[model samples]
Target: MQHAIHPAYGPVVFRDKAADFAFLTRSTLGSDRTVEWEDGRTYPVVDVEISSASHPFHTGTARVLDAAGRVERFEWRYGREAA
Candidate 1:
């Protein structure tokens, strides 16, 4: 490890807007936005689109894509000769 060359790593807040969830963790990424955490301390807040709280895979809400149906629909729509 080199001195004065590595990005500072400290506590940060990662917020998932969609799930309205937030958690505190260590990160090198800093932000100007700040938020008061449960411990009554302010930390840099980062807004994220998805996290374990709202992720389909983590929440077991993932849906299987209907690829066969999509292919059939596409064929029916474009594969028809000008009849």
Candidate 2:
């Protein structure tokens, strides 16, 4: 309820580089870069490295780790000593 104390909140475009995905949403984040959207409006564009679109879990391409093999290797080298 304060005046001129809050950050500007408006449309912001989030871009995912790996997945090549971009979406517009309201946010307080600001950027110097701008891009012309499909709606013929320019908004601040923010570049992101990863998101749900490109993440392995969301894409169903997550790699399963071999815990047994890692434990065997550790024991073989450390001789079961709790360090």
Say which candidate scores most in lDDT.
1
* lDDT of candidate 1 over 1-83, digit per residue (tens): 77999999999999999999999999999999999999999999999999999999999999999999999999998895666
lDDT of each: 0.95, 0.94
Candidate 2: clashing pairs of residues:
none
- lDDT value for candidate 1? 0.95
Candidate 2 lDDT over residue span 1-83, tens digit each = 99999999999999998898999999999999998898999999999999889989999999999999999999998789666
Model 2: number of backbone collisions: 0
CA lDDT, candidate 1, residue 57 = 99
TM-score of each: 0.76, 0.85
